[model samples]
Target chain A: MAISIVVTSGKGGVGKTTTTANLGTGLALQEKKVCLIDMDIGLRNLDVVLGLENRIIYDIIDVIEGRAKLHQALIKDKRFDDKLYLLPAAQHADKTAINGEQVKAIIDELRSDFDYILIDCPAGIESGFQNAIAGADEAIVVATPEISAVRDADRVIGLLEKAEMAPPKLVINRIRSKMMQDGEVLDIDEITTHLAIELLGIVVDDDTVIRSSNQGEPVILDPKNQAAQGYRNIVRRILGETVPLMTIHEEKKSFFAKLFGKKK
Target chain B: MSTKNVKLKGTKEGYTIVLHDVASFEEILIDLEELLLNISKQNNASTEISVHVDTENRLLSDEQLAKVYQLVEQHSTMKIGKVQTNVLTKEAATLWKESENVATLVTTVRNGQVVTMPGDVMLLGSIHQGGTLKAAGNIYLFGELKGIVHAGYLGDEDKVVFAKFNHDAQVRIGEQVQIIEGKGKNEPLEDTTFAYVNDLHILSFDQLDQIRAIKPKLGNQTGGLL
Candidate 1:
């Protein structure tokens, strides 16, 4: 059976869609059959992020409302060679159009066909979020190093725990090494300790991520990018492979300084 | 003949009707009615005496208290000032005990989470920003408090909150609120600070030493040092 994972963030604009798109692509790159479902109805952007906006003839709402078959609604990515597929959200439909049971039925139908199914959840703790998480067996909470994002992530984690899904993993994204080292923003250790969840991986704040998304290309298509490496590590971890957390800063300290440890 | 179970005594304040704890309900009612009837006949009808009903070591149900009040009103012009009972019902006693003891909280109060206590709270976990910790009495924190802490939530103004000061937090005691924004965010101003409602009904922060003088009964519930 395919392991369905829901990517959610309580606050808006914290890279939930980007994480979902990249992770879905990364899994496909490993020769796994991956299907991405955009659950953000009425405000759909996952198809645009995946550069498959023009190829979408039918959306998830069409399948749920019996207007289209499930296979007809799924769009294939030309680059993945029958590996990655996306079920786009209906832009015209509101979140209330589809309920949790419908989403679960769709996920259950797709379970036997795919190796991994990733659902891109919308921001906020509303009905859309509940519907997205309802069909998910596991959860990934995306958060930035900013206080507002971390606070919202904390709230989401609390809700996810109450939902009784497998202990949700945390992905601290858009991290700036300089800001963290300067103590301007919350550090990786602080964010993980405060959220108190299993740390999946950390993504650096790469300008190329936004640029690539604007061109309808996920940054994970490139291997050299630091942010791409973060996504790759997260995918490997999800695939049950052990990967050490990548160093965000390459600052080398003196031997004695390392032995005594720097004061926090 | 003088009444056996019920006695009427006049103190400096007013008349007090002392109901015997061991007296049978029927006998007490008959004696009390006889005593009140005699008083009503002797006193002028224009005078209305309000007497205190003291049920020493006797617990009366709501129905029994109402019956006592009804008997007084029917027999004479004497009004019951109030019913005084030395004992309490199980429910009332449980509620009182809950409010009298300190509650221990040992979990992280996350953002958007609110933890409320019936009495004083001794918290051993952190409170994140956007989280709230409220108590009907005082709040004693042994963990990081980065959120809003409200003491005397039920509006008894004398309660206080004691914790290490987090500048980003808002302190509320009773109806008074003091936002600690003037200080730098994430800065710990004092190792030990307390938020209290002062004499002017304003929320104020002070050092730990002043708490003893401010709330003398705090932490010394037994009235003696163990």
Candidate 2:
């Protein structure tokens, strides 16, 4: 049976698609048969992010509407030793064209063959959000340190709870530690307590995530990047492993602190 | 003259116009209007006279009541005194409920989202810089408060405003306003801060234990997490 999860954030542009792509890739790298299902529908970007845009002869809507076979629509990624498949959403369709029930039925059909199914939920509390969560048994809420992002994450958590899914885990994306110490933004402790949810992981603010996406690649493919390690830890945690979070400090001023006569 | 659908009676204060419950709405309205027209012709006096509208053992819909009011308004000599919904059943129950006096915030009040609520307002998360919160009653912030806040917005000077953290926010309660200037390094020396009127001054304090010890009046509190 597949462990189905939805990656969602109430506010747009907080790295929901990026996390979904990376975590899906991370799980596949560990020799798991992982499938990344893009539920954003008309606003689909997972294909471009995953560098699988050209391989799409069919899409999720085609498979669900019985225009294409499941095998015909699933695009295989050869980057991983195991396998990473993507079910790209249709670009020509509106979100309302598909409802929750149809999405649930599609996920059920793909569950038996894969070890994991990660859904990229669309932003907001509209029909698209409901459709993405319809078949998900678990959820990971991605939020930035921004107040607007956290607030939207809170609302999404409330909705996820009401939908009867297990308590969703939180992933704080784009953390800026230096800014946080200067009191310019909220830190991990403040955000976690205010959101009142179990933190899955934190991805430090890195240009690698954006550069990788533009190149049609996920940041997780680059093992040297700190944000890549963050994604790996998230996959380990989801697989029932205990991993300590990445240590984010106030820009490591201790080297200067001792010389400047500041008490250690 | 007495019409079949309209009954005009003389009250102690003035004339009373009663409409039949079983009559068609148009018939009742027309005859009642005609009765007012006749009364105006007979009196030939001032355009306004104090009168009562009696809906006999029936509940009139707003449309029917407005028509009756308009009928009296159209006449040159009748002014409305009282309109009665006597022997009514279930109309008042569903038509009204408790007043809306509470506002809830489960998410961040984003920049440019101005929230104005009556009675008490409770925020579960922080309000971003461009957003402003206005409440008629008290304001409680379970999370950070970085935006502008106006409590007792309906001019209730007794309402209190509280928050867990600050970001150089401006607060207004009643007639007094307080702006936390500079970098917000000096915030009441407490983990949780609260502001309210103390002797006509908008005083802020972080010492909740001392405030609880002093027992300042925190009035008309409303909403929080259930």
Candidate 3:
């Protein structure tokens, strides 16, 4: 069965689009045909983050409105021509132009052609959010370790439950293991306790993520970076492979290493 | 002129009608019959039309009423869907009166009580612990809602707000207005609050909630028996 996952967070700027781009790319790297959909209309950044901004001639709105065929709008990744594709959101239109049914129809068409369809949901719980989750078979709730992000994630969880899309998998992104060890930040256990969802994987704070994003390449593309390794582990877990979670101690070295001379 | 082909108009019991004035009722019936035959043949879908007439001066005998019924029956395409007197029950009349602008179920949070409303709600509490509260309508945090609060959930943006304290990390209504960093700290006023986007950015208490009440009401208005 094709797995459709929605990467959503109640709050904005908590690494939802970043995670979608990385995970989709990581899955494609694993030889699984993956398609990442950018549902954030008007302020679309997925194409930029994926380094396919200049290549998007058509977008999701065109496919839904029948202005363009589905195959015509799908931008194939130059890095992984046959394995990965991007369905960009419209830049000129707002979220109101599309609804849940139209999103479902688009995803249904994508199901038979790909192994994984990752929808990068808009931050707030509005029409754009609903449109992203309407056809999703599973959901990945991305959150940071801060109290505010966790609280927003909790609200999103409550909404998922009410929408009959409960118990979404959790990904605590940008976790600072050293901060948690030194009592400077909330730990994974504290967040899991409050969020009450199954843990998929935790992505530690790595400067490599920022650097890679600046370079217009996801960290997953860099196999040497610890954050890249973390994304790979997440992909393995999604593929049902029994990969052990990387120790927090290993992540601390990279943080200090980058602080000194190591190029992250 | 044949009276049978002339269309007729009259009151029958409680119903009224305007018929095609041809020559006689029989001629009118023949024209309607031909029209029905043409419609059924043109479209496979079932189509039907019916006419009834009653007059005290030219009271149609039982035989005449029977003739009209028989003429309608002869047109296979035309079938009478329903025939009923125009009378509404007192219960139905009252139902119509009660159906306008019913208040929505809202969960209200005030002082300490947390009441959920059927529509949307308002929050009136000091969310000191840095937790979060969300509602389907506009959220009005009367006290210092220092934690997080989400409004315009389920995609409703017309909902707005009022708040005395806005120290929360975020205040989101629909897709707009995410105050990640609390709006610093404003001097406590008798009644100060904030609303969602308008002609201006985030409307401050002095601008939007002009209802100079010090402590506003909060919590779900829906019945909370417990």
Candidate 4:
């Protein structure tokens, strides 16, 4: 039986799609058959993040609307042989084009075939949220250290509890440890306190996330990247391994190390 | 005139017996009967009194409305008309009211979400920055209130907005709005706080006992929306 998890954030631009993409890729690294479903119809980007945007022929809406079969619409990850696949969302279709029941049924069909199904949920607590959360065994709420993002995450946590999605885990993404130490933004503990949910993992602020995304590659594929280390730890933790959170040490450049640093 | 707080609205069909939401159905019925009796003694105007028992969230059952219709027939020479209601509001209202209470909010009100309630709201959780909670009655918060809250929505300035702890929350009581600035984590603003519309200004008190010491001054206690 596959464990379906929906990655959601009540607020927009809080790295929910990124978390979904990275976590799905991280799970596939464990040799698990993982399928990433982009549920953010009309605003789809998960396929692009996984570097499989050009391989898509049909979308989630097409599958639900009977235009295409589930397997026919699924795009296997360009990098992974048989470990990872992606069901891209329809850009032209509205969020309601696929109802919760339809999404749930589709997810149920995919359950027996995969080890993990990660649904990249759209922002806001609306029909899209309801649809994305349906049929998911668990939820992962992504948030940043900012007050606004944390506040929205708190609301999302409350909503997930209402939906009764197995006590949603929290992912504090894009956290600036320097800012937290300076008391400029909320720390990890403060965010957990505000949201009142179990801490799943924390992704420290890293520039490599954007660079990897521009190349249509998930940052988790980069072994040396701090954010990738964060995601790998999360994947281990999900596999019931007690992995410590990645320490966001200050990026110090020694005089000789900087002088002899490898050119990009 | 609404004699003894019994309101009669002139509808296109005839007159509607507007019931007070706060008062019991029986109390409203007695007041309506008294008003009809007084009207009959004054002049023989052929007026009808069809009860508008359709309320938001909770509507009177057919049997319950039948009792009112039969009671009005026995008390006065008024014909009952068909009752209509906003069923959507009634369903949404009753469902929330029944499942939870004024003090227990099942979910945190997020930004861009407007929570307009029928009665007093007791939010057991925090409110987001752009989130709003408007009610026809008072608002009591046991958690942080960092959002906008407008209490006394129906123009009852006597209503108050209270927080379990002090924070940078903007509260409105009818026309009066007050914001306690700075971090509520320390200093003069420490401890729980409550605010009410007193005179033309909004009065905020830090201690619960402080409410008893201050004599409320008169002010405009009507018409404010957020």
DockQ of each: 0.52, 0.05, 0.03, 0.17
The parts of candidate 1 lying over 4 Å away from their true place are: A1-3, A31-33, A69-72, A76-83, A108-115, A158-167, A178-184, A214-217, A250-264, B1-68, B81-94, B182-189, B222-226
**By the TM-score metric, which is better: model 1 or model 4?**
1
Q: Tens digit of lDDT per residue, candidate 2, span B1-226?
A: 5688888888677777787788888899788877777777788877567777788877878887887787777775567888864665664442222113446768655455677775677888776565688887788888666678888887777777887645667788887788876645455644776777776465555555655643355532354421
- Sorting all predicted structures by DockQ, with the top scorer first, yields 1, 4, 2, 3
Query: lDDT tens string, model 3, B39-153?
Result: 4566575545454442323334468556656765775534443323234466755544333213332322211222332244445434433455666666656555555566655
lDDT tens per residue, model 2, A1-264: 998999999999999999999999999988889999999999999999999999899998998788999889999997875489999999999898899999898899999999999999998879999999999999999999998898788778877877899989999999887887787998898889777789999999899889999998899989899899999999999999999988977445577796896766
RMSD (CA, angstroms), candidate 2: 8.0
lDDT-better candidate, 2 vs 4: 2
lDDT of candidate 1 over A46-96, digit per residue (tens)? 999999999989999999989999999999999989999999999998999
After superposition, candidate 4 runs with Cα above 4 Å error: A10-12, A78-81, A91-96, A123-130, A151-164, A251-264, B1-109, B112-123, B134-138, B183-189, B199-206, B214-226
Score every model by TM-score. Answer: 0.78, 0.61, 0.55, 0.69
The Cα error of candidate 3 at residue A6, in Å, is 0.3
The top-ranked prediction according to lDDT is 1
Chain A superposition TM-score, candidate 3: 0.93
Q: What local lDDT score does residue A190 receive in model 1, on the 0 to 100 scale?
A: 84
Interface Cα RMSD of candidate 3: 7.5
Model 4 chain A — which ten-residue stretch has the worst lDDT?
A244-253
Error of 1 at B70 (Å): 2.4
Q: Is model 1 an incorrect, acceptable, medium or high docking prediction? A: medium
The A-chain TM-scores of all the candidates are 0.94, 0.94, 0.93, 0.94
